[model samples]
Target: MTEEPARRRYDSLRRTAQAQQTSADIARAARTLFVAKGWAATTVRDVAREAGVSVPTIYAAYGNKNGLTWALTDAADLSADLSRLLAELESAPEPPRQLAAMVAYDRRLFERAGEVIVLLREAGRTEPELAQAYREARARADDAHRQVLSTWPPGALRSSIDLQTALDIYAAICNIDVYTELISERGWSSEQVEKWWCTMVIRELLEIPTAAT
Candidate 1:
């Protein structure tokens, strides 16, 4: 009887592992297709073929193209970097250090997920549902920005800059579009982009002026 129970448990574990592997393979295939064919042109069938799975598997796992894009975005997220940088920002004693931590996190994020970032941006432009979702996500980011800035020491921000304006400036300059333009289109290195991003954010949002100015 014990042997039978052990066999059942092993089978269950194997099935679970296989399912996880299938999901990962599907996600990888979807990402490759999305990048190569662009979001609008890539289909579930294409991904299924690439992953050696069926169309039903893709639908069951990810629902639709939008779902796959979301999954890809989640997979590409560098949560470890975010946590480390958030901790670094919190412990930072001064505004410059805090800003550096924030910028560093953004740099890491864009560098690792530049293609996904571009994919999402393009998808949002053409897909109404995703465009709404993207707007909502940006709204959440605004809230997060407010919370982070609230912890900063007095006089860290420019006297003329309000919370809303500060968030807008950050969004405009540190966003994926600008990153794509600089890094992908203009052939700028990741290091160059990070340095330029840091300079722009410091000059636009903070009281301290960048050396370039």
Candidate 2:
């Protein structure tokens, strides 16, 4: 009985590892296809072919193409992953520094998944499922931003700025369109963008001069 239980544990661990690897492979393949072909044109068959898994596996792991899109979104979800950083933001002594750190953290996330996010925004225009997913993703980030904002002691924010405006500024500057504008189209380097992001987030949102300028 002891031997059988040990064997079962090993089998379970192996299956878990294999499942994680399979999901990673699928996500990687889907990301490539999405970037190359755009979300609207990329189909499950293409992903299955790219990932070398069956369509059923894709569906099983992530219900459909839109489901796959959300899986991608979840993988890149900034709110889901910030532990130490979030705590750091909460503990920061001033609002400007906290906002700067938050922007820097979110900048790294956008750097990783900005292309897919842009694709989803384009797809969202015509596809209802993707549109909903996109909105929910934004909501989650907004909620996180709000939580961080709430950590500020009273009067840390400018008297003129309200909760909603602060959240809006955070969302707009950190979103894909601005990223695409500065980093994608205008040819700003990642360093330039991150610097600008931190500065602008501090100035416009927190109403403070960035330390550099």
Candidate 3:
């Protein structure tokens, strides 16, 4: 083959690889757009155009817009990280320490959940499946918190208080929506929020008397 023809063939191969890479990139971009703009507003053509590829490329790689969405959702693990944080709190040393740890853990968890929350909030408007998934994930988190509170030190205030009540209290303070509203909407500093959360948890759940400095 002539050198010119050989170079043309190599360039064609390079273009094919670049197109495949663009498909994956488009899938990710589509996820963000879908979450930010909603599924009804976003289009496969928009995703392909954003990723600098042809619409046919996206169809070839993802098969369809729904396939791309499913791929993105399956790839992300928003629930798993929250569960891991709760597990860490359960393994913590003592009630006081666990309460403090849980506060910090939840802060971190919310940071990760921020994107997922946006997706869920937008998805809930039109997608029943997505809404159901969000609810199931939230229930799992609540159950995890309840399990952690069950390990609270004995003789805590309102020892008569039911586990559900304790869980509710913790959930109220540590909830991702509550945290975002306080930290982002209300402009509370993270340190202040964490300190207050830990104090509340310590006093209510652990029943620790605060020492005067």
Task: Please list the C-alpha lDDT of all candidates, in the order they appear.
Answer: 0.67, 0.70, 0.61
Task: Give the alpha carbon lDDT tens digit for every residue of 1-213 in model 1.
Answer: 354443442343244334445577786787788778877788889999998999998899988877776545443443214446545644553666666666777778677766766666667888875565456555645665676676566887899998788888988888777877887799998789878888888888888763431
Q: What would you estimate as the lDDT of candidate 2?
A: 0.70
Per-prediction TM-score = 0.65, 0.69, 0.59
lDDT value, candidate 3, whole model: 0.61
Candidate 2 residue-wise lDDT, 1-213, digit = tens: 354443442343244334445587677778788778877788999999998999999999989887887655644543223543544553454677777777776777778777667767778898888788788878867766776677567766667889899898778787777877888789998778878888777777654455632
Residue 90 accuracy (lDDT) in model 3 = 37
Per-residue lDDT of 6 in model 3: 36
lDDT of 2 at 166: 84
* Most accurate candidate by TM-score: 2
Alpha-carbon RMSD, each predicted model: 11.1, 9.4, 14.8
Off by over 4 Å in 3: 1-33, 40-87, 209-213
The segments of candidate 1 whose C-alpha lies over 4 angstroms from its true place after superposition are 1-30, 36-69, 208-213
